[model samples]
Target: MHRRSFDRFNWQDVLREIPPSHIATRVSFFLAGFLMALWASLVPFVKSALGLDEGAFGAVLLSIGFGALVTMPLSGILIGRSGAKKVLAFAVPVASSLLVAAALVPAALPSTAAVVVILFCFGAFFGAIDVGMNIHSVVVEARSGRKLLSGFHALYSIGGVAGAGLMTLLQTAGLPGVGSACALSMLSAVVWLFAGRAMLPDAGRNAESDGHGGPKFVFPKGVVLFLGAVCFILFLVEGSILDWGALFLMDEKGAALEHAGMGFAIFSVAMTVMRFVGDRVIMSIGPKRTVVFGAAAAAFAFVLAVLSPNAWTAAAAFFLVGLGTANIVPIAFAATGEQKEMPMSLAMSAATTLGYAGLLTGPAAIGVLAEATSLSTAFLSEAVLLAAVAAAAALTSVFRKS
Candidate 1:
């Protein structure tokens, strides 16, 4: 948990202690990224297999979101009371199973109803895993007292890149739909099992029994709520990039099919690079200033992205947006953990759930609005959201002394 322990542990000690914990984080991140990719990759296959039109496909996608919404709050409670390791231990297998089942169902039954059911289960499992892994990351980062958190998150993004790229690659290579999905599922399951042993010991029972008195349920106080709102807005921007960036290029900018992914790819690469550099940035600038400046920069980036004429300018804008958003969520998580109004675990759960809602719903909300008006209008609206974050940052004086 500490830098000193890194060298002091014998090979066996390292294997028994550090390796599992580190591996857990890595596997969790990899699987999360893979799950996101599986959706994009399997969409065409799902459409074909289920004999669904775009409207029907949209309805199926809505089922996934609803399942996530249903499960996230419950998953938070489990992680709060039982600790991340236990929850994740269960979640990983369930999620992997769902992925495999979802892959199989289309071929076996090949119906819209079956795909919807499978996707709902997949969404629930993914939500649980998301919260559990993040809880673990927070605990580890706290013990180390350094800026490892952002780098840890970087791994999740790296996994996303790998997942999306691999899906595209396999599809191009002519892998069958079921085969590709099964391959990812098996890979994720193997990685998760191998990493399970290294998880940080669950302190939930110990904390509760020791009479420090954990909260009865998860909820955020005023400041935590403010921070949560900030997280929500920031993540909404990220969700937009992930889901809509390609569409924006293709539909509005006339980008070719092959080039559509470039917008998101640029955003992903820029975000990854910024996170690797985030530790020193936070240390030097401090969290408060970092959030303030980061929000401001991101707002500016969104404006540039919306206003830009050429695809090249838009791509560069996305990169800037990624750079601006790189550390804001990590900083918010750190702040949430430091808040004193409630049990850390409960408060964190609340913050995470609300923030994740932004990631889950924001894209669709944008899409709905875009349908009523224009995609550019939707993007400009997100720029407004970032500007709202900037105002909140100023009010929090997240840069001023706490």
Candidate 2:
């Protein structure tokens, strides 16, 4: 599909047709972020109702990752056989409904098993849509012959910021967690229904039909594996910030508990700001330079974040980390979509699965490293890893001329 569409895209294509395509894919990314934020806001309420301690709650959180890991690899194959359009239309609505279910389950039953089952399903559907939307966006961006992936991703980041604040405001207005989840779910449902019509109907299907499709799955070998590893390392950096940044701020940097939350907030805002300009950055310098420079900057930011004297300084450092790390994933996915090692959809599946594996393991990996040594050491290791990523990006052939 992408190979055929990239011959040329004019103003007529951009003005008349591209809007709907971009809108369709953008809504999927935004819906994923928005619903996930709604779930994040409900965590405290769900934990209390489920009667779980911190350790047990942590264990239960693994269920979400487990579900995503199990299903993410399959989404690519499903899109290969069917199409991103159908998978997305189904997955997005189901994922939204499951977010509401995750919120309401504890209130209704309060069973750990029940909560686990509901959240697992939610994560499964979320993973499917996540892959589907990304694959779809890759196609759209390719057809447009412009650096549009970063802008599409910026909406996902913006959705995260907006959803969290919206949920808080809804709760402040006297809506319960269940109510807030329901409200957000409705909004996402509307987007899914409206956007389904505009998605590329054969985004993955043309490349995946009988006699032309490859094996059931494409092994992430050579360059695909190399790019997948880069994504993994980058996601590990992000997961570290999301899961442990506040603790580091509180324990090592002398931040108050209430104030420590600002670390991620600032980090997120910085990332969003960078991503808004990332399309321009990629357009200006190209993907290789973008990855090389961005990774190096993030490595330095991680080191500074750990070494800063005060929490405020560390917060600013983390903001830099977010800024530097913001566009790497989008850039990696774009490269993956163009690889010829395997079918585009299956290759995307493999890359996304590996990257998410980093998300699943990064927090626990940090916890283990911190237990054995210290949080500072754990974070410095991330810096070392980021440096490696920069070197790899510089040396690898995965990033082609854009």
Best by TM-score: 2
- Candidates' TM-scores? 0.87, 0.92
Off by over 4 Å in 2: 1-18, 206-214
Best by lDDT: 2
Clashing pairs in 2: none
lDDT of 2 by residue, 1-402 (tens): 786677665677676754788888887788788888888898998999998999999889889888988898888888988889989889888888888888887889889998899889888988898889899999999988899888888898878878998988888999786787787887888878987889998887645486346458667897788878988887888888888999999999999989988888888888889999999999899888998899999999989988899999999999999988899999999998998887888888888999999987987899999999999999999999989988988887667553
In the predicted model 1, the residue pairs found to clash are: 20-198, 21-198, 288-398
TM-score result, candidate 1: 0.87
Per-residue accuracy of model 1 over 230-340 as CA lDDT, tens digit each? 778877888988899998988877778898889988988888999888978888888777777887888888789777887778889899888888988887877776666
- RMSD (Å) of each candidate, 1 decimal: 4.8, 5.9
All models: lDDT? Answer: 0.77, 0.86
